[model samples]
Target: MDKMQRMEQLVEQLNQYNYHYYTLDQPLVSDKEYDLLYDELTALEAETGITLPDSPTGRVGGELLQGFKPHRHLAPLWSLDKAQNEEQLINWNNRVLRLIADYNSKNPDTPLPDPTYVVELKFDGLTLNLTYTDGKLVQASTRGNGVIGEGILAQVKTIKSVPLTIPFTAGTIEVQGEGIMNLSVLAKYNETAAEPLKNARNAAAGALRNLNPRTTAERKLNAYFYNVGYSDGIRFSSHQEMVAFLKENRFKVNPHVTYHDSFQEVIDVLHTIVDKRSSLDYLIDGAVIKITDMRTREVLGYTDKFPRWAVAFKFEAEETTTVLESVTWNVGRTGKITPLARVEPVELAGVTVQNCTLNNVGDIERKNLKFALGTRVFIRRSNDVIPEILGKVTEEQDGGEIVYPVNCPACGFPLEQRGAHLFCNNRLDCKPQIVSRITHFASRDAMDIETFSEKTAEQLHDELNVREPAELYTLTFEQLIKLERFGEKKANNLLKAIEESKGRDLASFLYALGIPNTGKSTTKVLADHFRDLDKIMNATVEELTELPDIGGIVAESIVSFFADPFMQAGIHKMLSLGVEAKPPQQAAPVTDSFFSGKTVVLTGTLHQLGRDEATARLEALGAKVTGSVSKKTDLVIAGEKAGSKLAKAQELGIPVIEDEDELIKLLNGQNE
Candidate 1:
């Protein structure tokens, strides 16, 4: 092949590999192999003076820019309305539905149905508007006030994930996406830096707006396309179609985007994203839910600031800067000495955070944390209820040095240093430790005893001398009534709740036992493997380690916990006091089912069964029910008003069952 042709071929292969590695998480070529091919392309381009616009060589780095020019967006890039909670999200959905209803009322002949929503992750990064002309990248700008923005084409070219050229030659098209710095990239960058970046969002913004493109390239920024601000000679019936078009043109569209017919499903997706936020490689502040139908979005048009058809359901504040007041030590059920930093109350994301976790003495030392009163410290809260200090934000230090406590804050016992963590050995006599253990034992995820707050646990521990979980079952209504905030009715309710907790499942009982490193999921795994408490207690470290997902640390923790005389006595006492731990029921084998080993996606409205019911039924038949329709989907059971998913399934040539009757027949091994 000629030099230009060879470069084009190389670009195509590299782009395909990039898509597989980044988007699909399944790389076809090794990094070393990719690098060798890329180097050859770079050398060929340099020798022949023929550089392909979409070649991977362009992402190496660019010349430093003197200044950024201004670019006006063809169409206004409106912000999304904010929804801090589920109720707010529902209200926004209701308003959009109401608007659609009004439009239907005006035009009765062409009535609009309730619109499906396209939910996407709201990436916490800098927004970039990319404009393409005649299949070539022309302009890239930041979202400056929605109308006009600073041009950053030089810096944008460094993002390897973004396509430098697309296949659209009709006219101009504007695509909006977020430029993000990966958490891993940020950590690597901060290793040798004098002043580290504050957060990923700031790192992205700083990199994108940097005067030096080489610096920006070194940051290794990534982008994910979400919206099309403007398009010419192209038409999309829905947002889903537009996104699919973007993906077809080799844009790095987020794979997490899904189309949901019900608002509850959208909310569920939002919650799921929030729960899995910490596990994600990138930072996302919230989930954006938008009306999928293009016509519906037009009807429920834009307000002054934000689009009426879309809303951002934000999670609790992940990052904020607050003044550090002092540090306090708290004793946990495990007697671990955890440092709690009391900070000046700051509103982050939406919640006010006053106290943040310092984790341990080692963490404080590594972060170079100085608990100087009045100094500003960066606090970050992940999926945890307690926030944690990231680092100091200010230089002015007024407070004294933070001194590690020699003795336990609750009891007079000396703190013992153990592998970067300090622990209090007084597990039996420490008041705070006792209170925490009891409180955790009766927690919702544990024994699930209603009306058993931490304050009530403390009260019971102090007044009634209740030290252990078994003692809780022995408390009488009269004894509870003597305590403060405990009337006759309240006392009766408390006693009844404790009594009702006796039938808690084996997993819950195991978690409630306060075994170190054993969480709810681990407890379930243990319970499923052992089938009973006795089997779990009798299992050796080797056997425990052999269980799925149970490692040496967890296995040793479990075996040691069971071997402890105090723990054994506590379990026996609880069992004697009528705490019946029932083993979880085993699921029936599904190897004989017709739908076994298939992946199914249910979409639209089912008449004969609810969505959850259909999902459960499919799962019971050994079919994995997924939320979105992808190339991996074997079958899609679409019902009435089937929208994006149905269209996608058809486009991908995946088999589809039209109704619940068809699905049921398929499950019965009847060919449709």
Candidate 2:
């Protein structure tokens, strides 16, 4: 075949392998083989006239910029008034309620629902704005001191969660989301470092500010959008309800959001979260307390800064404003595009600052920011990694209105919207999508086919027409002999890696699918509960939701997945290639016990084992766990300062037991 034909064939195959590995979780090739193929393709592309926009050659290593310039915003990115303690919170709550009461009392014609509040776990991370013009992602910016910040268009692209384009057919849309670290990123990064990370939030801020896009990818940072920035005539009644709308538009949102009828309900929700905060996966520094009515926010209006209708009660200092320099974009494992912001290096508490997250195209409109144009912006860097643009308008200046992209930079596809997201539909031909997917599929967690690397996949797919992972097992030594750096033994090793991936756990397979909302924990829950993929696919949303830890979102994703033709076809194809998932071994059914329906609270200290172990044992014994001491507690197992728990148990007059000795004996008794 001619050189042009060969190059086209190679690019297509590499991207397919990337998609399966990166986005979907299944990898079919060995790194060595993939690399050899990619190297050959690169050489050919250089020698021949054929060029592909999605070529693996483009995603090579690059250096960080010398420095960043800031863009001043049109509006000042003002800081919020914070409530630190219960008294402050109560005082604020009283004032808000009194305002509504007075407003309603004066205007007897209109009755209100007591002006309820929506309480959400204030994510301890950076804030961001993604501007979408004509429903396409264009530019991202930091909330410069609430006025101006740096521009990080290229750096923003590194974050996969931030969409490069909006999926809507409308002329414009903006989104707002919190850019934060993944659940376990810090722990993993710190495990090998000289000084392990102190917390996840810090790691997130540092990661987003990183100049290296590849490093940003490795951190696995994530973002969830919650508000609409600027839309032409977009309609929504309440901010709480808008969350649902954003999700419909394909934006990520906080899972712990709730509405309340009274301040007590709001307090109850807030306290409940604080009590069980440790159990939450993502880091949270405070609670975002807001009025449920949009009109109320407008009526309350803003002072020089902050919305009078809303207050952020910070729990622990996780998010603090810094300065921004720029924003960049990246196409993730899926065809979806993401945005990140780059900022001028500044110190928040201790760590140096630079960039944070703008989140996606929707953010730009919501934040209503101009380019940094060389000004300081307020960036909240959590724990020193995931930095997000929040406030920065120190002074007002005019920059051109930020616009979103209309076409995919990778495949040039018009973006398609799904709920709160914008996804590129040219998956079949998109180069970046394919490469990213392949990288993920071949990752150690998926297939454990360690021989495959992004470089290798690029080579094999683009140079050799190896479209799918399964094709890796089909390569011949004769093909290797024709490549640029031919060596038969290396080719053999690549073949060996493919052979080893045939038998992997069902959990890994599910994770590899790159199904939306399906992370490692959810994968384990679904796999362990169902025991097989067929059952998971056929199960109704209700059935899936019934499983503990398997939430409604995950169930919906599984259902929606089975509803797709291409995924089903891919599944059958994979199954035909001898790809199989092994179910986890389970223990024999244990005897019924008295703790079956009881809830237990273990506070302060436990002498027998750590908290996780104790919780595990309690769960194994069929007992539910509550973080706080309560009247409904069947028994309170207190150890030492168990302070509040001990006092609360006494107040309720519930029987309080101490130590594992008595608890074990009580369990043996089986009832009384």
Candidate 3:
């Protein structure tokens, strides 16, 4: 046979081998034999400069793709209501019952049958929506918004388990599933990876979202389809039927789906799943409970956000025990010493965690870990955040004592106890404190000096003697060029960047000051309220506390930060060096605008306008633009690819302006 014919034969053979091995978990051939055949096909394809459409080489990934195009889903990918506890689960069931009762009461002749539930593992990974036409996988996308998603067909094709073609010659269908990196796969990848991934969920999601399909293939992702969201000429009486359909079509459907005739039985199954959660190879954050009967699901219908017949029973954050091997104290920019606990590496939430935060020395004492080093401690990680030590596993104080340092770890300065924290008052002499302060001042949200990094900060502190933010303004190109790795171009670039940072806005300047217990939001509020540096520096704690989101502690921190003689000297020096803390331009008071008195939230990427500009415009119209969505939020302006914030807005029934045109119109006070 010719090369083309042989390539076709090999492609079909390799596809079957992949299906048997990856989907059915049964290898058809030895790895050596498979590789030989694959290599032959690869060589032939390269020789001819042509590859067939169904070639197995596609699974190896192709060239990089341009940015993802928005794929409008045929059917909306609905979010599920969550039940964090048994009480919440029971409440959800009651709501379903009430809805079903009301529906059956209206239709007496053909009343819906009593609800039965289907429980499936809720994989904690990226949501994938795949579209097929004429048995060919045409498109794959992320669950961006319920209505639209970013098309990622090349990334999805890299998954060996995702069938390129199916036996079902349907007109069109959209299948919904989760793309996940198995915990085992993640661990294996980390062994050889230069930069190890932190978590399987993030690894899978980041891979799929990567512009290069080669990166996605490197992750070796697996998918499990659960729901047939859209079908042209297909129907299922129950979710079980849908799963069977997915399985029949060679889609990898998870095998953990269970059916129960009663809600109480479903709850029992959930508890059983929770007990076995740690044993699973993949990450499952919860169990999804859906009404089994499709007709009943139709009768129950959906809320604005989620289906009334379905709820996700979310498991509590994973907790595991590990030995608290030792504790190391580190100094921050504010000179506060934080105790970091080194523990025996343990897997929690698909990540091997060896270090956990103890917050401060007081946290160590309060958690009874003062004498618990070398003993097992309970560490809980929630929402993929850094793990925290809950307490020791046992009441016995048999482990080694955790000694608190009397001096700063970095500078050997005498420490002072303030509240629960230890502080080093050495601002000028401490290397870590100075370096961190310089880094923070040049951070993107602050002065935004391009190419500035922690290493650069360290080099400046050690070599240039640039101990403070104001000192940065004094460095000449001649002095900078003498430093290690500093060429003439590099020195000039650094000087230019420093020159540009002198024009940073007042809010950014305030944040760069690194006030203790204060954040960017508070700084922005201060800049907006005071609009002048001298006014803010002289403002009393009572005046500061009158601002929104400013508590007594924050007020005191601001007041105290300005009160320091060193801080006063720094500000004066910065001003003398021509640093312009330019106040925002004043706008006319807007009391009668549509956004006036409204609590608004902006999320996702705005193609037409920048996020900061949108915020400024909203604020100028008297709108209180917050970072998160809540019941108090009167409106949400969601741009393209809006995620959880948009979902929350929908769940809370807060009105959302999704289109850029509509947002612009609203901003201009024009009628819809």
Candidate 4:
């Protein structure tokens, strides 16, 4: 046979060998034997000065690209709603039941069947959408914004398990999978690299996104296909069928793909996966739960953000260790000093974390971090909050001591010990404290000043000699116009906002005052109960504590705040400058409403009602709206994409009202 014909034969045989070895993890030929054939194919391709598109030799690294071109996906990639715990998973199942039942009710003649589910690992890696026409791989792209993605076909071709050609030569189709660096591969690569990679996920993602395909090839990435996003001449009745098609096409399918007729069985599999996660060779932050029935998925349909038929169960907070380099103290508007620990930058949960909250000096002492400077410490990040230093790696203090400050770092004022916290009493003179106070007073919850920001407050403080909330009312348009970035329109707008804030009701004014230990809820309660600011100011600690949700600490805070001469003078000055602090007019109690006397919680996105509007309506009807699910909750109004709280409510067996129409009817007194 000629070289070209021989190359063709060798390519087909080698591709089959590759499929068995990489995709199937069952090698049909020894490494030495495969290399001989590969060498011959390479030599023949060089001799002919040509390479076939489907040749096994195409897997080699190629020349660098100038830039990535945009490729719009044939079908939009959808994001799944997430569940953090089993309670949330249960809630998702409940939502599925309701949607299926509602659809079945509408179409009695062609009712949908009870839903089965498929669970697969949510791999921590870059998402790849590969397009094929006539069973030949034609395009590959990232999941950028879901609709359009950066084309990386050259880079994707480097993945050994990815099939360049499939047996089915039908119309065009798009297959979705995750491009991941196996943990073992990452470790092996790091052993000899000049610059070691911090995590497998970033290594895979960076390699795939690199301009040079040769860099991607060196990563030795693997891919696991689990979805057929678009197909012109094919369709699947279930997720199991789609995965089977992927495997049949020689696409690498994860072994953990599980199907169950029962949701309980699905949960069991998830628990097992979590337990076996550390033993796996790749990184997975969570597991995805998808309904198996295509008809059921169609019935459930999509929210603007995610499909109602699927949800991701995320694992707990990720933890990592880094050196505690130093700690910096910051003073807040409340005069409390907080310790901010600066640590050696470490990759955790897909981001670099260099700073962690130490909370206070007492937290440092309790965690034995008082002498943790320059020592390794455990840090944890959860729910997207700032990372926190959990504790030192060991009890032994092998590093220098974390010296406590005797004076405020922001203003150098003498500090006072207040239980577990240290306080700086120079509230009026301290630059940080005064700037923060002014900023808080003009915040959205407080005065609702338009275009007002912390930087604006700082400028006003430094350039215009403005300090305290009352001083904001005294500013002139002429004064503001002279400041940097302040034009005539901006100055007038600021003045207008300041003037409009004078008519704000008592609750907002109270919250703007920045009373220690009191939040917006407490201020609202104080306003609603007392009606007048003077009454609240004169209220004894006993009287303040009598109200619901007001504990001793809150009552003491309110009493101590109003008792201060400086605070009293500030309130008086604001009133003198036309600040109304208007009391709300009394209305009859909502004693005979459907939601009256009930404790309710709201979760998820409501298409018909904004969360704030829903909360206002619930409060108007005498419902005590809360932020969490608990035994005390009488009802839970779950909207689209409801997650953990919805699950917690279901777990606690609380009554749930998911129908927007029903909620609107009840809210309108039609149901009552």
| Best-fitting candidate, scored by TM-score | 1
Q: Put down candidate 4 lDDT per residue, 1-672, tens digits, no spaces.
A: 888899889999999999887876567888999999999999999999989889988887789899999999999999999998899999999999998888888999999988888899999999999999999999999999999999999999999999999987889999999999987688678656755565678789999999999999999999988999999989999888888889889998887778899999988989777655544567788999999999888889999999999999997547789999988888899889999999999888668899899888767776778788999988866435689886777878788898889998988999999887999999788988899999999988888888899999999989987878899988998888889999999999999999998998898899999999887768878998999989999999999999766889889999999999999999999999999989866656698899999988888678888777898899889888766666668999987656567655543457888788899999999983
Displacement of the residue 213 alpha carbon in candidate 2, Å: 2.9
Give lDDT tens digits, candidate 3, residues 418-492: 877999999899998999999999999899999899999999988878889999999998898899999999999
Please give, for residues 1-672, the per-residue lDDT of candidate 1 as tens digits: 787788889998988887676654556888999999989988998899888777777776777778999899999988878988878877887788788888999999988767898889899999999999999899999999889999999899888778877888899999999999977678677665656676788889999999998888888998999988899979898987999899888888776788898888987878667655654567888888888988887778888898898888877767878888888988888999999989999887557888888888876665567556567788887544578787777544555688999999989799999976999999888998999999999998899999889999889888999888888988887788888878998998888898899999998899899899877657867886788899999899899878655789989999999999998998999899999999976678597677898878777678878675776677778886666666678888887656557655654557888768877776667853
In order, how many clashes per candidate?
A: 1, 140, 0, 0
Please list the residue runs of candidate 4 whose C-alpha ends up more than 4 Å from where it truly belongs after superposition.
Answer: 1-317, 588-593, 601-610, 626-632, 636-672
C-alpha RMSD for every candidate? 9.4, 23.8, 26.6, 22.5
Model 3 regions more than 4 Å off? 1-285, 292-317, 589-594, 601-614, 620-622, 626-672
Q: Candidate 2 — worst ten consecutive residues by lDDT sum?
A: 18-27
Score each candidate by Cα lDDT.
0.83, 0.66, 0.87, 0.87
Against the true structure, what is each candidate's TM-score?
0.60, 0.44, 0.54, 0.54
Query: What's model 4's overall lDDT?
Result: 0.87
lDDT of 1: 0.83
Q: Which candidate would rank higher by TM-score, 1 or 2?
A: 1
